[model samples]
Each structure stands twice: as structure tokens, then as C-alpha cells.
Target: MKRFLVAPLVVALAAVTLAVLPGSPAAAALIDARVGALTFRPDAPGTGARRLASASVRQDLYLDRVSGTFVLDAEPVAGTTSYLRVTFGHLDAGRSCQGDLELRTDTTSPSNGFTRSGRTLRLVATERRFGYQDWDCAFAVLDLDTNGDASDGSVRSVLIGELTDVPARPVLAVTGVQLLDARALRLVRGVWTTIEVTVANRGRADAARVVLRGSGRGVQVRPTPVGVVRDDDDTTVQVRVRLTGKRATTLRLTASGGGATASRSVRVARAKAPARPRPGTYRSADGDTTFSVSGGKIRGFRVRTTTRCGGYPDIPTTTYNTYSFRTVGVPRNGIVVAKEKGRLYTARLQLRIAGGKVTQGRFSYAGPAACFAVERFTASRRR
Candidate 1:
């Protein structure tokens, strides 16, 4: 790490004579004094090329009735040396002095040239070293002493400062996208669907904000605004789209931030008309078995027996057993068939009905049981 040593002349240059001459005028007495220091480091390991750490220091000094302030600012310069600027405020008695400086590397002292314009002093060094490392740098500010004897003047006070820069470029990428609504699979014309797009920052810098844009032929798409995304972090935004064409369409979405952009696409097809089933409660001729059909599918069923079929055991002879079935295909000609397949058993059922009533049906089951059978029965629709 960079180190700074800021000490008053009275404490640092005690060997220098400050005594009054017996036959001459009295020497100026030491009064109030202050010292400060600063250090800067890279924000990240690989970011040193584009960014730097920042630091500053301030001090107040008083001599008798006079008071003054000193401020230091420091920062790293891209592809160049570190820069330091010092400002002097409310100098005592309005006194002005030129600043000379040296850059210290261990025991070796190298002169780092400086210039003073008005009350500000500036220094630049080719070695951009700071923080703890094998080698460190220190800056020393020097000036002529109050004593008329030039040979007696020596090091008096010191101060420190630092600066850092942030990465200049940002890289954005779209990592993944997903459709939020189940309707995305059956996208009908003139209907809207929700989609989620995830964005990530793959660069070394953070993005303060990201903007999303979406477009597609034969569809209107809108995207939600995404806020900040840090380096190596990701965020998701919502995109809503409505299909307006009769054919399949592709929707493209783009995420842009900090001069970087990424895009993703999704394909949607026009929906087909759903099969319509005769909707009503259906029952078998024995009245001990029943089925409910809705929206062109066998939605529910009940059976009375001692044997288990398709992982479902038959109900007691006094009661009916009920369970649900999944539709696997479109209904045809007022006939709806459904099936339930499991590791232990598989079942198939075909129901023929019309005018909101069941006319006839067949239910079959196959499993490890040797007595597996198919039963054909006639049904009557409930009034």
C-alpha cells in the first residue's frame, strides 16, 4: 500500500534551528498544525486497464492568529501515470510558496516533477503503484523553510490522496427465455401471451439500467422495463405478445444495456378448433357404474367391483368408485375415448353418446392380474 507522512516542521525537523539570535530578532513560534494521507487501489483485478480507485484528504493548520486549509486529491490515469492535485485555502498572512515533490520507492528517492498554477499544485508519476504490494510508492511535498538559512531548511509536512475509475464498456447477453402462459402452446389469433426474458451482464462492469425491445411479424409485442444489472448478475423482464395473423409467426426480443445487446426468438402457431363432446353425466346399464363427459372428454368415472384396475381399486358392492381420466385425442362423431396408463396398470374407455346422454360405452383394463377383462355396457343419460 501507498503510505504518506505529513508532519509539522516542529515535530519532523526538530534538528533544524528555531532559536532566537541573542543580537538579532526573535524567530517565528510554531503553532497549530494538521496532517493527512490517502491511498488508492484498483476496484477489481482485471479492471485496472479501464478503472481506478479514488481517495482524498483534508487538513487544517493554524499559526498564532493565522489559519489555513490543505486538500489533496488523487486518481489513476488510463494508460498513464497516477495524478495528484493539491489545493491550499485560507493561507496564513496570504503567504504563497512553490511546491517541490519526490516519489519514494523503498530507500530510493526519485524526483517527480510538479507544477503550481494559482493556489493548486499538481503531480504525476509514471509508476501507478498503490496498496500492499512487493514495492510501494510515497509522495513528499517540499518547500523553502521560514528561516533565511537555505541550508537549514528540511522536510516539514506531508499529505496524501487517491483516485479510481470505473470500467468503460458493458457487455449484455440474453441467457434464457420462457413462455409464462400455457396458452403459448395453443396460440390463437387475436390472443395475448406472456413471456419472460432473462438478461445477464457478462462484462467486468455493472449496468445502471437495461432497455428491452421486442418485435415480430403479424403480432404486437410489448416489453417491461428492467432496472439495474450488476456485473455477472442477471435479471428477467416480461414481454407480452398478441398474434394477429392466421399463420405461424416468430417473435424476436432484444436486451440492450451499456452499449451491448442480445436477442432471442420464439415461434408460435395458429390454434385449431377444439373438439366438442356431448356434455352430460353418463351411467352404465348396471347403474353401479357411471361416467361424466365434458368439453369432448371423459372427465370422471365410477365403478363397483372388488378388483383394482389401472391402479384404482373397485369400490365395495354397496358403493361406487370414482376417479379422473385424461383426454389423449379429439372426439369424433359424438364418440369420446380416454385412457389412463400407469406403471402398475393401463386402462382404455370409449363412450358413445348423443344429445347430452350416453347411448353405449366400453371399458377395458390390462395389468399383471390374470383376470383382466373388457366389459361392454349400455348407458342412460341422467335427466
Candidate 2:
């Protein structure tokens, strides 16, 4: 149950000869230079025999060759297995070619198996034999299978060549962020605004399980999850934030993945005083609904609605109706209730008046044992 993960460590070389002289060719290009070795151990009690003794790797750029050796501290008991992961620094030169990798080992029975993910290699080894199982990779992996129950020693020498298939390691960077909603330009205190944030990934590989975080004074941001973003591609996500105070502020958004992070900020300003409700016939932006307002009442209110209940069609049917309602609060904002009621639901409307018109509103029809949906809309005074 113990797992050891060896991260890639860079081992700097002081000098790399590149020039070719008579009868002597230059070494292969050092596309990647890094720490080339790692070791793992088993910590679980009563499992000392299953621990990894040691591991070593070497790279000879001139011959395009990579080699490694692995040994277990002791022979493991039957049915006992240990898992280990090791990462070699930047071994990929291009896209990962699991098929281009050629593997060889000493023992083939009681086989140890291994798999590759990106540059990280996973191996399952026991006391007998460790060998490479079928896997795609961008780096070298030693698959060992110890010959029949050898209680003496488990030593593996892996000779691997054809190292040209490794891909360039993928780099993740948050390229940019864009505010897709105009409401973000002017934020109102104590009101929640849902804005669209477009997160872009300019990377060599797809970013998985991406997350967006927002921060600011007088602001409350809802952390958003943005799933896989393919290399060079972008995805947009919605973020809901509330400004709790009148002070102007800025909202900072950051996206991170693959050890890289990027951030962008948006300016927020206190909203101006709201304009009074203007008396006029207003039409919804969609032109599918309309309502008229006079000082303290809403008239000629019309919208589509649906309801489903016992004795009604399984799928709610749609219908349009004209309604009249009295404002129950301030002239700028109030709830309007219709006098008529159906057996399954009652109709109600909430309206917000600003900038000389009915700026936004919600219409709902609901009751016990019924399905009622709230429809939200915006309308401007008809010109």
C-alpha cells in the first residue's frame, strides 16, 4: 500500500561537445538534460521483503541510448506486489510515441509489469520477476520478470535504445481571460451578478480538471470548475460574485494546471443611482413578452406559461395570457400578483424598474403538486 513517486530532477552537465572532428562524430543533440535516476522503498509493516532496494539510470546522447538497473531488497512473499513511479527529467523530444519505445529485460517469467503516463512510468514488481507490460510511452521503462522464485537476488539490467519517440513535455499556461458580460463593468452593492469568464489554455497538451478562482475586497466569488481544455483551445465558464459594499474594487481571476498559473483582473465600479420607472408600454428584448406600467400598477402584462398536474398532460402545455396586477412595494420595484387562479397554480410577477423602464422581471406560476417554472426577462420602453 506504500507508494513512492520520484519527481524529475535536473542534473546539469557542465559542457556538451557538439562539433564533429575527423573520424569522430558529435554527440546526439541534448534536447533534454536532467536528473537521470531515482529510488523507492516500501514502508508498510511486515512488508520489508517487498521493498525496492535501489534504481539507477544513465543516458548516452551520442548513441541515442538509455539504460537502467533495478534491484529489490529481498524476495517478496507469494501474492505480494509493490508499485513504484519514477520520472526522468524532460526525456521527450516530440509527441509521446508509446509504440516507438523498444523494451528489453533479463528475466521473462514471474514478470514485472510497467505502464507510462506522459513522462511518468509506473511499475508493478514482486520478488520473482519484473518485466515491461504492453504500454505506450515517451521515455524508457525497465520491465523485469525474475526467473522462477529466486530467493537469492532480484537484479534487473535493462538495455533500451531508439529513444527518438519521446514527445516534448507539455507545458500549461493560462494564456488570457476575458469578461464576456457587460454587467461586470458596473457592479451594484448587495446584488449578485453572474458573469462569463473565458479561460484560455495556450499549452502543448490538454489541461484537465481546470479550476478558476476569484478574489477581491467587498466581493464574494463562487469558485468555478472548468473541465479539460485541449491544447491551444479555450473554454468559457460562468462565475457568480456579489459586491457587498459601495466601495469600488477589482476582481482577480486565476487559472492553474500542470504546474503553471495565470491570472487576469477586471475593474468594478459602484453603480449609479437607479432611474425611476417610466410610464410606458415596454417590450421584452426577445419580443416574446410585454408589460406596461403606470405609477404603481402593472397592466397589460403578457407572457407564456406552463403547468402540469394530475389530470393534465404529462408534458406541460404552453399558453399565453394577459394579466393585470397591483404593485405591492416601492414604485421602482415590487411584486405583482394576478387575481385569477388555476386549480394547480397561482401566477406572480416580480419587476425591477431602472433607467426609465422595466429593466428586468421574473414571472412564475406555481402551486402544490405542480411543476412551475420561473421565466426571467428584460424589457425596454418601446420606441
Candidate 3:
């Protein structure tokens, strides 16, 4: 069997463009964290300086638009042990760099065909001296597939998941899900596989909104959401996933790649949209009447409502537990309300104060049928 990886080179234009484009329109926007900045260190015991001389090699790695194909320059990190730790970090907008991944050497060559197992990337080394007894050598690829800032997170914390089980007992992960309107897709069931990914975004200002695409014997994940993380002024990255088996099906999760790309260490069991109005106080203009809030507390309610479905049309169906209040500086405990066509609502409003001559205040609400529960007492702050 022959390995087929291109030589790894220094940073290329593709990487540079993604990293150094702050004056452009995307400047004010989110730059891809994976290509933000990059840092890869060669760690060896103090005694292995001899091996270091033979392996101090550099490579230019290019990630495809979808985070799948990667082209490494035709060179190896100079001489030495087959077990050197290769770390790849992401860089955000500035040139600030950070570590992203560390690969273990098994049967490494100029060209390598990598296999993915669950969330791990595996490559068998032909050199048996590296001590890999199996038919092939293995390495893990870390892909967080999230949306925030990767570099913003500390190196120790960000790469914690990646650091833990480098020599992992491969497990399949649901990298992405593509909902097929096709009737055939609906008939399929559970299947799995692994994915090696690298993202490329035309614009470096933000994480590219790209999705992962995969095909299985039967089953699929529909519209997987990817989070963006900005790290390493070198926000550029390459990640891999392990997926379980499904019937004949295809699943995809899109993300901005390259300067637009964002990668991280992620663990996903499964994702699904949450249900509405399962068990909570509800207020609605038109729906099945279920629950309500009453008493003075519901009247002095002072909290923002979310169930934010949309605009006015959404408001009528909003299960927001609206309450009115008279006195400020009172501790208000909020609750969940389902959107239902009802008359009154319920709430609990609390007021804390020390012993003193207290003034009487009033509470009132003139909206549709509003109700509340009110309780007053003195709560001394801990000394």
C-alpha cells in the first residue's frame, strides 16, 4: 500500500489572504478563527536532538471549501522519532496564533492517505520501528464544529478535548445531518462513518456558513448548526469526525471555511429542536386554554419575554408570563409560560428590606386578563 499526501509547505497565499484581510469589508465582521494564526511545535525529549535534525520539515496545507480535502507540501518535518507530536493551531483576525491539533506519527511519509474512525484520523505507518504493532498507524483529528471564538478560549481549555485521548479507541460521531425531502430518505434508518474536514471561505471576515455532507446506507442528520470559534490569529483549521451507520441517506452541516472557516473540539450525541409549551404558565390570544397566573405577583412582573417566535403574529401566541410591579429594587423570580388562549396568568414577586418604617405601594394591570401572586417580607443580606 502506498501513502498519497502532498508535501507540507510554509503558509501559502490562500492562508495569508485569509489571515491578513482586516481592511476589507469583512474587517468589521467575524474572521475565520481557524486561519487566524497558526502555531505547530515539535516536542521531543532532551536526548532526541539527533532525531530532531532529520525531521525539522515544513509543509503548506490547503483546506478545500468544504473542509474535506487537504493538500500538504511535499516535505517532512526533519529527522528523528516516528512519534513526534504535530500540533496545528488556529488564528483569528490579527496574526495572534494558537494551537489547534496534535498528530502522532505512525507510518508517516510525504504522501499519506488518512482514514477516519469516529472523530479520529488514522494513518498506518510502513515503518515498524515507530513501535506501531498494528497493520496501520493511527492519529486523531479534532474538529469542534461550533460558532464562537476558538482563540478566545485558553489553549489549555480549548484543546483539552483534543489533548485527552490522542490514541483514542475510535468512536463514530454524527458530524452533520442533511434532511432530504426525498421519500427514499425518510425510509432509511441508522448508519455511520467518519469524516476528515478542512474549510475554505472566499471571505476572511467571518466563519463561512458551510455545511458537512455525508452519505450512508440508510439514515441522516438534517441541517446541523455549526458554531464559529476565533483563535490563533491563524483561525485556519482542519478537523475530522466519526459518524455511526445509517440506511441509504446523506447528511450535511455547513460552515464558513478558511478565513471564513472555524473549527474546534466538539462532542455531539444528537441535536433536535425543543418543543414549545410542554409544562409552564401560558398566555395566548388564541389556542387551547391550559394555565394562568394570578395574585399581586403576576401583576408586578418585570422580566423580558422570549418564546420569541417572531413579531405581532408571534406575540398573540407568546406564552410570556407578563406581570406588573410598583416598587423597584424587589427580587423578581421569573417563570415559564406557554402560549395559550386564557384569561389570567400566575407569578411570584418578592421584596426584600430591613426593619424600618415602610411605605405602602400599590400594583395594578390593565391589559387583557392578567393575574399574579404577591408576597412581602424582610430578607437580611449576609454579613
Tens digit of per-residue lDDT, candidate 2, span 112-211: 3544332233343232111112121222222223232112233221111222223222244444443322334565677665566777765456677778
Ranked by lDDT, the better of candidates 1 and 3 is 1
TM-score rank order: 2, 1, 3
lDDT of 3 by residue, 308-343 (tens): 223443443334543433322311212111121224
Best by TM-score: 2
Ranking by lDDT: 2, 1, 3
Candidate 1, 1-383: lDDT as tens digits:
11122223213222323222387536523212222233322112122211223223222121111111222232223332222323222211212112222222111111233443322333433322211111111223322232222134333223322111222355788777654213243355675655557889876567766888878888887766777778778996656666788888887878876767878777777765333555678776677667666665565576554344343364322223333355433334444445678988777666555565555566666556433556666676674
In order, candidate lDDTs are: 0.46, 0.48, 0.26
Q: What is the Cα root-mean-square deviation between model 2 and the actual structure?
A: 19.1
The stretch of ten residues in a row with the least summed lDDT in candidate 3 is 156-165
Clashes per model (N, Cα, C within 3 A): 14, 16, 126
> Which parts of model 2 have CA positions greater than 4 angstroms off?
1-184, 273-281, 284-379
